[model samples]
Target: MLGNGLLKGLTETARNFFGSYVDKDRLTTIQYPEERAPRIEASRNFPFLVYDGTDPQAGLRCVSCLICEKECPPKCIFIEKSTDKKPDAVGKPQFYPTRFNIDVSVCMSCQICVEVCPFDAIKMDNDFEASATGRFSDLLWTKERLAKSNEYYHHIHPTEAADVDAVLAAARAKAAAPRPPAPSAPGGAPEK
Candidate 1:
């Protein structure tokens, strides 16, 4: 009876060996490079920021709030706020960022910058093709490198990007809408 149990196990193994070949046609093992593979949209592997180009400034939505720089675990973000003179006054601190940089080599891509940005100035991009053969300083990304069109964002993550756009549009509409005219006055004559 003990030998009979071993014989049953061997039979099961043999059955499995044959089943593998029998179901080979149903299996999907793509040959790398030779056979192209389809990518699913929900996969998130890279980090990038989305820019709205509608603005005349080429649409850098970051307000230079320094939240991203402060929250960055690695302190990869470098920002330089610009000093602009007021239109009516003589001297004033405009606080517009004249320079912004992110050391991509050190960035962990944790998406924390994207999450903490109150202005939605940053988002995770799907571009994982960044490579360079130079010093660490060479990998430092400037604002120019990070900027990406809003359309590109929608193309990468259509559902999520569209939802965010819809919300933004609604908020803008509410802000732009004029307030209702004052209830006419107490009775008929307009109140001064």
Candidate 2:
């Protein structure tokens, strides 16, 4: 029965070979570069910053916390907190990054930066076609280049974006709600 396994494998090969004509799914081989396979949602290549509004610089959500930079295993992320203040979506003054860079050549794409980001400012990008002629200069992405709109984030990660939106909405609602006046001192008496 040692040859039985070999025969079974050959049978599968024959079925696939013959089925290529009748079954569209059976044809796995294709002309790449002209026609590419669809990328799955979970596939991660590099980390990118997400912005909330039209202006990438003004709408940036990174509070310059440096959490992602500290957590990155490959030490590919770099950031510099800006001295100037900018109002965020909530109308609070926040410090945006003056210079944020990621070295793609040294980056291992481990998704650790995405995981460690508390602000949800960092997310793994699905783009894999980053070809650079010069490794050091061309491969380095700046803050301007790394920032993508929330819509772009939604386009790339719909499910994750939805979840993040829900959480943000809840937080905004909580922040916007007026706090109930502190209960009057015991027995409806005001204490000095």
Candidate 3:
């Protein structure tokens, strides 16, 4: 019975080995670099900061909350909040990251950073070729290097991007919606 199971496994391997020659569809191998396979949309590599509009710095969605940095398993992400506030993608004044860095070498690509980001500022990038000659400096990705456009995010993960866009759009609409006037007290004072 033990030998029978081994024989079955060998038979399947042999069948697959011979099938490639007989069946053209069975030949799955492709020439790397020159004829690379199509990228899978759901495949993720590393975390990238997503910006809304044309300006990467101005339109960045990150409010420098430090949630992603704290939640990062490898402690790869580092962030410094700005003193002054600037308008974000939704035109809400927020404190942006003055200094943001991610050590790619230490990162395990677990997508935890992306998951914990409340502002939807971070997303997983499909770029896998982050090779470096030097160990330290090259692997440490600065805010400038990490910032990517929303269009690029959409291009990589269309379905997820579309959903994020819808949610963001709803938030924008809610923020833009005129609110009812605050109730005033009897003696020309605003209600607490």
Candidate 4:
């Protein structure tokens, strides 16, 4: 019986060993660079910010709230708010950030900045091609460099982008629609 068990184990091991070569056509592992790998969709990653290029004030979404800056654990965000001119207009604080910078060298890609932004101004990009040599400033990205077209975001994440656009469209429709007249009180009672 002991010998039979050992023989069975050997047979199973040999089968597994030879099976790989036997089914080699089904294997899909490709050598990097020599063979191109399949591309991953952007929604596989967490959300990030994007700008709408056709809008002249695309960057206006980032109200200089500093919420993202405060929430950033790496302290990579640097914002210089502009001076406030008007005091009474329900205006967001006038501090237009003269310099908004994120040091890619220190970024952990946590998506915290994207999460806390009330304006939905910032989002993560699928682009991972940022590589350079020498100097910390070289790694620091400015607002201009970070701004990407909303169309680009839609291209990367069609489903999610479509959902967001649908919500915006519904909100615009609701805002533009006329309000219904208030219902009269039940049994002809005077309306409050």
Candidate 5:
């Protein structure tokens, strides 16, 4: 009648209110901490190292290439290559990150670290609950803290991890293949 326009809004509000009780999908509000939303495969927050096997340091795929650290726009990543080489997940004896650290307080979460890493060691984590009480110690996460199992990486990003794993397996197979011996000279003398 007089308030036909207002009546429509009121009717919608009533419908929404009743639907919230009956319809499982009608609830729009998500209770934090207790009720977590569905995981988004593409979502990323902070950078974490991906390690395979039981040992985090030895199994780390980083290879101390420093690509991620160099590409980080904020310069939040710091890494020190180990002098001693260790067998990595891909069966290559490579230098590991002895002093890898990330200033999470200054990290912008641009995901450049994950993108520039050639070894697939770095990936962005979906966990956004990195609260720090102390600035220096708490905010600056070391290699041990940042390291996560390969399974964790797969859990967070199944498609990306699968692609990376395929490349790693190929590399390992190539490295394992026997190299052909060098050819000898015309007079049966080995080439210098």
Candidate 6:
């Protein structure tokens, strides 16, 4: 009983070692640059801001609500709301983030920012190649560097992006729908 656990671990190691030689499927190691494993759809590395269209500044989905910044466990997210308002994706006048930065060195890739964002403006990017020589300055990603188009979001996360698009379409439809005319006051009200 004492060495059973150790024996099991050893057995697994031996099996894997022998299996790698016999079975190609059992081989886990790959040449780093030339050959790489297929990326998992659910894999997420860091946070990036999602924008609607061509113009990163004008089409930004983030309303600069500061929710992500407040909710981030590591306090890596920073945002500065703009003084003037800009029309968001839904054509509503909303304050856009004038200054947004995320310190990747400090961020733990917890996806809390993406979860807290109500506007669907923030999403986890699968780009894991964020290595930098300098820890502080090089890793601090700015709004410009972090802004990615909706198409890119769809490419990285198809299912989730499609769902988000459907919800947004419904919202847009609701906003565009006409309102019923206001009823006039009782007949005699205007008769002096």
Top candidate when judged by TM-score against the true structure = 5
Q: Write the per-residue lDDT of candidate 1 for residues 17-113, one digit (tens) a residue.
A: 8877998774567885687565456765434556565542345666678898899998888887656522211122224456788888788878888
Model 3 residue 183 CA deviation (Å) reads 10
Q: Report the number of clashing residue pairs per model.
A: 3, 0, 0, 7, 0, 0
What TM-score fits each model?
0.66, 0.80, 0.79, 0.62, 0.83, 0.78
Cα lDDT for residue 23, candidate 6: 96
RMSD (Å) per prediction? 7.2, 3.9, 4.3, 6.7, 4.3, 5.1
- Poorest 10 consecutive residues of model 4 by lDDT? 85-94
What C-alpha lDDT do the candidate models reach, one value each? Answer: 0.70, 0.87, 0.91, 0.67, 0.88, 0.91
Q: Write the per-residue lDDT of candidate 3 for residues 11-114, one digit (tens) a residue.
A: 99999989988998888789778887777998998899999889998888999999999999999999999999999876778999999999998999999888
Q: Write the per-residue lDDT of candidate 4 for residues 124-191, one digit (tens) a residue.
A: 77665567785776788887777667787777767767877787668658867998888877798775
List model 5 lDDT by residue over 44-141, tens digit each: 88899989998887788788888888999999999998899877765767888899999998899999888788777899899877887887899999
Model 3 misplaced regions, further than 4 Å: 1-26, 180-192
> TM-score of model 1 relative to the true fold?
0.66
- Candidate 6 lDDT over 1-192, as tens digits, reads 899999999999999989888999987778878987766789999999999978887888999999999999999999999999988765789999999999998899999999888889999999877788987889999999999999999998999999999998897887789976878877758755
* Better candidate by TM-score, 2 or 5: 5
Which residue pairs show backbone clashes in model 2? none
Better of 1 and 3 by TM-score: 3
- Once superposed on the true structure, which residue ranges of model 5 sit more than 4 Å away at CA? 1-3, 21-25, 180-192
As a whole number from 0 to 100, the lDDT of residue 175 in candidate 6 is 70
